[model samples]
Target: MSDTLTPPMQSADCWTRREIWQQPQTLNETQRLLRDNQGEIERFLRPLMEKTNLRIVLTGAGTSAFIGECLAPWLSRETGRRVEAVATTDIVSAPDLYCEGDTPTLLVSFGRSGNSPESIAAADIAAAKISDLHHLVITCNPDGALARDPGTHSHVVVLPKATHDHGFAMTSSFSAMMLAALSILSGVAALETRIDAICQAVSDILHNADTAMADLAQRNFSRVVYLGSGVFEGLARESALKLLELTDGGIVTAFDTPMGFRHGPKTFVTTETLVMVYVSNDPYTARYDRDLIAELRADNIAAGIVTLSAKAEADDTIAVRNLGGACDADLLFPYIVPAQLFALHASLARGMTPDTPNATGTVNRVVQGVHIHPLNP
Candidate 1:
């Protein structure tokens, strides 16, 4: 198949070559793979959650890090375990601060290559310092070092090879890992049913994503703010980064929890800005999400306001109303899909390469630079 015809998740088209026209099929493959693997994954993840005093740590770099952020809160609430999404960069640089405490840690690492220096370093640090550390490496690359390690209580769930995106930016790989992590932690016995629904929604969005984002890209917004609460907040951060990266800084993007935005970040929204919120499925969190949408609408602070949710409610007209309804954490998959589409379209609109959006050549599929210094303690 031609690069454009291949699913964005598995395509070899560098970011520079992809078009807004090709994301739906890519998304469909993502849903199919996850659904097919649901049973096997559930069998493995359920027992892990049952362990007493489990402390789950989700870590990754860049887009990979955002996956943990999107999953942390939902998993914490669902499993009632202590879960935090830590950036590998943060954990590696300050291992003493993050890994020093006494807790049996389930260290979940998300990486596309599974070979980033910090990802490898963070794994080493956890194994060395934490007494009861278990590892779940969710990555696309089977040959990467993170997937090959056998010394620790580690299980590597390599996503379907199709998920390994060839674009300089992460698209399918990001969603696949996020879905895998959610399945591992959701504790649902009938996970196949839920997976089916989620996958259907993803397919629907990808079918329409290119056209939708191409239109949105026409707006002259210069500042973008993404909002969500709980698990979605981390998704907001990832969405913001995708927009920034894909647009190559053509737009300045920011992210915050819906309530947290009012504290200080609201100042960034002006007539030229776009404010997007990922609404929560739970009542309390949704109320907060809705209230913020109302506040932003009342203020008219930005040129446009968009809301994304599984179910269509009052906020639908003001926002995009993307999916029907899934677990709150699963929304991360759909939420990030739009951002990825938006970024690709926006890059094309700006005459920039979607595959290698960073024209200065700083980032890559396997990020370069930074010597993985040998651990010294």
Candidate 2:
């Protein structure tokens, strides 16, 4: 890892590194942008949210789709609405199954480029299937289809330009979109209160975690497993995908909830596996996470077990320094930093380009070669 951050300012100046390092600033800008636009957000959402039985469906493809999974549970509790995460890929493939025809629905679509065929198809399908449909598009490109072509029944929140990551694997785009969705859906004012701690923690991770992650990357673990619970499960999935994408499939990855792993996925682990657990801040959930970690350690089959946590649990814990008392939802932003760094380092160690790691041109930044079928009864 020649470019591995001793100076934290490599002469290469890759977009992947720039985007990964820029998260703290991008997140602050996202919150600020939301706060400034609070009036419009409330105006659009207030009425729909006030409806007797509204359904909020968060939908997108790939990394964008994971945003919904990460936020749906917390936002559902915060808003007391039926908030659900349905991937655009799923919605497009089987709109009849996921879309409720008569429901008063609000669709929050997340997209970096906003041009994925599935993303556009998902919105059209939702609109066609639901009678009272509203769209809230959170996207990076102002000129993107989702931002520019949203019909009169929609509102689009265009994130700061920096979040439109040029890299194949999403780094800043993931965090910024997740932050934007949380602030808008949960009340920007409320998130405003906690923004400083989240931003500071992320900044600290960027400043400090780079070298250690690089060192870990050089260890040459052929397999990696990421485990967590509830919202952290979604984070685990994103973390696994980051490594898979950045390493160009050179490193195999799996993601599961701490408890879910015992059911059978645990069989995937081997002597060459490196396991990372994203420990939940909730006491009850943390116990389950810790139990799994302990069980894996006792078995001693895996090469390593690392815990990403706000509270210290072991010698290998990558502590976020602050935010010990923060809710698990708040921990999401900072918890992802170490995973993002490791993926970047692993890509470099494997001699792949962090910005465009898929050498085969099979996987794309924005997916290609999909035929949209007629959604007929």
Candidate 3:
């Protein structure tokens, strides 16, 4: 923690900064909560898992949606069941495209507030379309419609209220919900150990790298690009959105896989752009990420490049320590911390109020102005 950094109580955009700083603690708290409720969660999921041909649909809006993307690949491989990441925004508008008429579906809904119109409507649409629909609602707001609704075969996991972010952007809420989902669905035996390692890694990053992150934010880049591979692709999307939202769209941003960036998105890179790559710990994936960083350095076209990695050969790379030899699935939690800090610092650097970046009020905390259509069965 830097002495110059404004205290949460004294800062103009207190909620956003405070929430960002509070993530490591909240993540541990979330892990403890999940452990305490493990019996109930497993009990609910056991019966659902017995059903043959089960299809798990992870759905949410925006950052919430990205959590599904991060989990789908890992969960699919672990559970040997079909896992799909479908945005609530997509399902609400076109339920038929996502939900099958007869599949035994588990719709895992992740919502910070649980109040987004799409959140409620997506669950309704899934129930209407899928004959054997089960829901696992992971959310922060206990009183929100998604949590309060008495839908059939639904189990709601409400995180601590402290996670219900007071800022326009989600900080603690997003990471906490993502942790809960992983703990419940992944069924890793050493989850407590993994949680401790993740917390330490994140805490170290926040403590040691604040100066560097703030310096990066102080740069004069007008555009930012975030790259990742596999499950990290979802994280890259969330990272890009965080920068865009916190900076209030003052900085243009893009997210793509390291290899995919060469196809067309590479053109977005320029002398005024800052590129950040979330390097995978998997040896095969790390090769491509390292190659991209090397190429970017060779070209010297971008203003700068930052790589967040568990392992890196470069001296200046942001290394996340105490990963507890976690696999890619477990690594996602710590990998996201740098991006969150970068977005917060960038917002402050650009004189944007992160707590309410959307000064015009077009974008809201719990999205407004969406009129849910009554689904006719």
The candidate that wins on lDDT is 2
Candidate 3 clash pair list: none
Off by over 4 Å in 2: 1-7, 314-316
Write down the TM-score of every candidate: 0.87, 0.97, 0.95
Relative to the true structure, candidate 3 has a C-alpha RMSD (angstroms) of: 2.6
Model 3 stretches astray by more than 4 angstroms: 1-13
* lDDT at 295, model 3: 91
* Model 2: per-residue Cα lDDT over 176-295, one tens digit each: 999999999888999999998998888877777778888889999999999989898789999999999999999999999999999999998899898999888889988998899889
- Alpha carbon lDDT at 258, candidate 3: 95
lDDT, model 2 = 0.89
lDDT (CA) per prediction: 0.74, 0.89, 0.86
Give per-residue lDDT, candidate 3, residue 58.
93
Order of candidates by lDDT, top first? 2, 3, 1
How many clashes in candidate 2?
0
Candidate 2 has a TM-score of 0.97
Candidate 1 lDDT by residue in tens digits, 140-251? 8888888887246777777767666777777777777777777667743444456545555655556556566668888857888899898888888888988888888889
Shift of residue 30 alpha carbon in model 3, Å: 0.8
